[model samples]
Target: MHLSIIAGSSGLVGNNILNQLCEDNHNVIAINRKPISGLHPKTTELVIDFESFLIDGSLPACNHAFICLGTTMKIAGNKNNFRRVDFDYSLDIAKKAFESGAKKLTLISSGGADSSSKNFYLRVKGELEDAIINIGFESVNIFRPGFLTGAGGRKRATSEKIFMKLAKFLDLILIGSARKYRSINAEVLARKMVSTLKSKPGVNYYYYDDFIK
Candidate 1:
């Protein structure tokens, strides 16, 4: 069984990934800002300030590190705070995991990520991808699913819900090269991320087709 460390254990995609990891009976170290309950018996959770942890905390040895940490500009209140969560905190955890001897790394990125993109959000995602790739893990998996859904009970704006419903219809029409832009469920993407950890060395990017497959 793998001993893995997962950051962002409280988000939609991250929470699902955590569940999958625990259900497989793998040993998990879940890091979050606050404590969470109802986790599997195999999971251990840590609550701490990310910036402080990065400066002083060290991780135990792990085979894989999964980073699902991210924040939106709106919720973050500004771009700097958004980057601190999405880029700074995420990169710091990856560094700690590497120092702890993790061979594989899995990250939850987004569709349309490009470092040189004019879009700020996509640019940050792309920059994070490049930074993580340079960490020299034995294997790296980056999932870029668009329009993620399937985290139940969270309040969403009505327009957002409508767009999600629309994604189902669009999924059918987004064929061929466009299939990568199709919407994917958070749980589906999490399962794919967990199953592919043993992939061959080198960086791998997964889109909607990759997750659904």
Candidate 2:
């Protein structure tokens, strides 16, 4: 019975989150770069050019904001462009949502994220987490699941599909502490996000156990 803002609705995790949000009866404002169709009845879709003044005062007052936008260095063309999407764009949207009265924030971050890591990708993820944590939201949920499965169509490559299927199957044997390293279904994480809309104040990190459960 709350309004939520969801950016990156075209992504595997975000799309699933959108579906679960609607099923839970929460009104959603879904932001996408391109036009889309066939979403749930509770969703209001906005095709936006991120920085243009289009969304300036148009976004509704929301209870929570979920940011699922991210891209690999290869897909983004370089580290700079990758930062533009993962860091710049994400932080911008978070600020906007907070300004519009969203008190809770949910972000889809990768596992092994470290601000000082030698790995560039994980470093960016860590930096984004750092930026949003201090953005004045009452609650922030960070999901750092490893090897996100069920991204079959999003990957759109034969080898990638095979890898994801293998990862999904391997989830059976990943037990105990090793469970944190297990591949998790995007839909499971999405449901977890929707279920935690009213988490306690401050930051919460969900690994395989908390999110996949």
Candidate 3:
């Protein structure tokens, strides 16, 4: 049976991915800030403060690892704190996962991620993507989805809500390269990530429309 480790199991995409893994009969080790409730029989939950989580032999060995950790500047209270979660902690776990024998890595990034971008959020994502790639996974898959649509019981910022509305209105107009910014459901994205693990080994990049197909 295939096995995978998922970080940020409490978030929308992460939680959905965890459920999909269990439904597929794959064993899952979920790393979260707190224990997840109603976990499936094949799921194992590990709780630890991201800031102090250490890499040791205790971490289970798996074929694939998913990094779904992320935070917004507003919720983080400051830019530094936001980067701490988005970059620092995520990279730490990625490195540990690699060391623990994970061959394939998947990261949930954003649509406009660019290392040279003037926008802080996208810049951090781009930087994290580069760092993770350099760590040398046998296969790396980076997903850059725009305006994720999902129900996770979490409050959304006013700006995000407006963006979602605008995205829906523009959905019919966007085409070609613009389709990469189209909005998608979190469950759809999660399923794609889990299902594509057995595909050809290489660095694969998926945008909004890629998940739809």
Q: After superposition, how far is residue 121 of candidate 2 from its true place, in Å?
A: 0.3
Over 98-139, each residue of candidate 1 has an lDDT whose tens digit, in order, gives: 999999999999899999999999999999999999999989
Candidate 3 lDDT over residue span 52-154, tens digit each: 6743424677888999999888899999999999999899889988988989999999999998999999999999999999999999999999878776625
Better of 1 and 3 by TM-score: 1
Candidate 2 structure quality by residue, lDDT tens digits, 31-82? 8888767888899998888767334535678889999998776688999999
TM-score of each: 0.94, 0.91, 0.92
Question: What range of 10 consecutive residues in model 2 has the weakest lDDT sum?
Answer: 151-160
Report lDDT per candidate: 0.88, 0.85, 0.86
Best by TM-score: 1
| Best of the candidates, lDDT | 1
Off by over 4 Å in 3: 54-58, 157-166
Error of 1 at 136 (Å): 1.2
Which of candidates 2 and 3 reaches a greater lDDT? 3
Kindly state the number of residue pairs that clash in model 1.
0
